[model samples]
Target: MGQAWRDWGGVIGVSACALPIVVALVVALSRWRQKRGVPARVAWWRSAAEIGAVAGTLPWIWMILTPGEGPRQVHLVPLRDLAAQAAGDPGTAVAQVGGNLLVFAALGFFAPIRVAALASPLRLAVLGAAGSIVAEVTQYALDLGRVSSVDDVLVNALGAMLAGLASRRWWQDDVTRPLCTS
Candidate 1:
């Protein structure tokens, strides 16, 4: 809906604006390292993935943590809030599900490629869940007027795990011999 899009306009705009800068910086850094007689082990995609992860995630986080006019809300029961939302507005429900899944997707997809220790679905899920928990706790603590629900955490972890699975082929091969040293 127009309202939903308008509400999320800032987040979308920020990510869109930062994308080109991130890519350019990544390219420049890659070139600089290569020119210094260092192997270009850090592929452009890796940099893009990392930068994109942060750029795409931060705006949503800001939106999440920003306090609204209303009082904060918490939903301790798993899926209760989600079910209610889905029943009320299917479109909103779908958008929420997709957004939650995507929150940590880039990190999940590219982290394993960059770090051997994180080259597993379980690790990615745990990491995503931990990050989601922190976000929820922050929302609750700050009285951000957002619903802190277990469903969000579960869905976010699921998204990360799925992303890890999607990148499994690359991770399995890359983990044995890391491409770049962080």
Candidate 2:
């Protein structure tokens, strides 16, 4: 436990400190929305979803953007890095895959709840891909000593889609609409 804390103390500490503020913000925003004539239930869900998205996602983004000691690398071929990882140590592969999947999970899980425009699994997947691309580009441009792999985008987008599916019950009403006519 101590070793785990030492390894992740900063992220843990910041998340701990932010918990109270997040709660207060949620309450204040919910009340403000109510004062503005929004239904209490609707306002609470929207406020909580919005805040939860940011609070849950930012730490992962921060960790991804952090510079590493290794030289920067890029992998344009999709699934190549993924296959390599799959063949590597089990722990490393799981961590890499799981971390990538979780990177935008909160956004996927909450965005449709808060905004009707983002109510589809396809939309969530696209959004995740675009966001992942931007992060990969930033990593390369900043020489952050990280590997910018297409596999990351693929996994991230899939993860978002999966999370969106999990939250489909709470998505806006139109979320059930068909993806295509054909």
Candidate 3:
């Protein structure tokens, strides 16, 4: 649970917030310089490809330091006492969801900025899975006080996909809509 929160919140969530801003900034600057309207940031599909590649691999980097099971970077919540009674408690679920979404979102957001070939959702899934796999495999290999879990990979991948979906339009057209649809 501790690790989940870290993976999701620390990594995924941070990425979600960060990547888009950077991508937008770059696109904005490019527009500022262009004499004609900034040419739609290389088409919608192109943006997707760019976003996917970057959105996919970030999880493996931090997995190295993650321990097997954790109270991990402890946050103060009064419910810590009842942790033993539940497997699907609200607190635990929140951690898992938040952490996974964050890191994956980060990947999604950064994908456009970090890599130029991430336009396809399928491709994004591939990279996202790859990142999760590497993290799990690395944990297994190093015996670095962590155990790899398929669930993490699945959640991470899903989160990234969601991020991609959220930015579907960003990948499709240079036309800005809502953050999720834009």
Candidate 4:
């Protein structure tokens, strides 16, 4: 855990500091447009969501892509090693599972709110899985001293689907009226 922090702390800290500013900027822009009688095509909340999603997710991505000081490893069998590891070290298991899930959670939670086409859980899951696959493949291809595993993709997609379900009430496609009535 300490090693992980040392590798990615700066990126995480920067992202944490930038998120509020990004949201604030989007809110201010939305208000400015509204005051000018120029109705927003996209909801301000959606804009904030998009920014937050990217800001929150990018640091994790950087961590995943950054090569460590060892040889790369690959785990082809899905969940086998994860299950073993869980049995051995519960704390590490929790952290790994939770971290993988969170990687794309913001994207899943916010994407459907911003784009009507992505409102379905299936779509969000596929999107999340695809993104995770790309990241895993990048790690393997780059020999980034990281373990590229199918389990990561599965967990990531599951996380995205869960987040999508949580945000179902605000899905853009579910709304009957325009976001801006003006």
Best by lDDT: 2
* Per-candidate local distance difference test: 0.77, 0.85, 0.56, 0.81
In model 2, the runs with Cα more than 4 Å from the true position are 1-7, 173-182
By TM-score, is 2 or 3 better? Answer: 2
Worst 10 residues of 2 by lDDT: 173-182
TM-score of each: 0.86, 0.89, 0.52, 0.84
lDDT of 1: 0.77
Candidate 2 residue-wise lDDT, 1-182, digit = tens? 57435655788789889999999999999999889777778778888889988998888788788887789999998899989999998877887899899999988888887777788999999988998899899999999999999999999888888887899888854322322434
Best-performing candidate as measured by TM-score: 2
lDDT of 4: 0.81
Off by over 4 Å in 1: 41-46, 179-182
lDDT of 3 at 15: 68
Write candidate 3's Cα lDDT for 1-182 as tens digits: 67556555676677678777758855555555343443455444344444444444455356345665542232234344234324657777675555655556657655643354675677767767787677667666666655355556666677777776676655544433223323
Judge candidate 1 at residue 10 and give its lDDT.
79
- What tens-digit string does per-residue lDDT give for candidate 1 at 43-156? 554555566667656776776776766777777899897788788878878888988998778778777766768887889999889989999999999877888889999888
Clashing pairs in 4: none
Q: Which residue pairs in model 2 clash with each other?
A: none
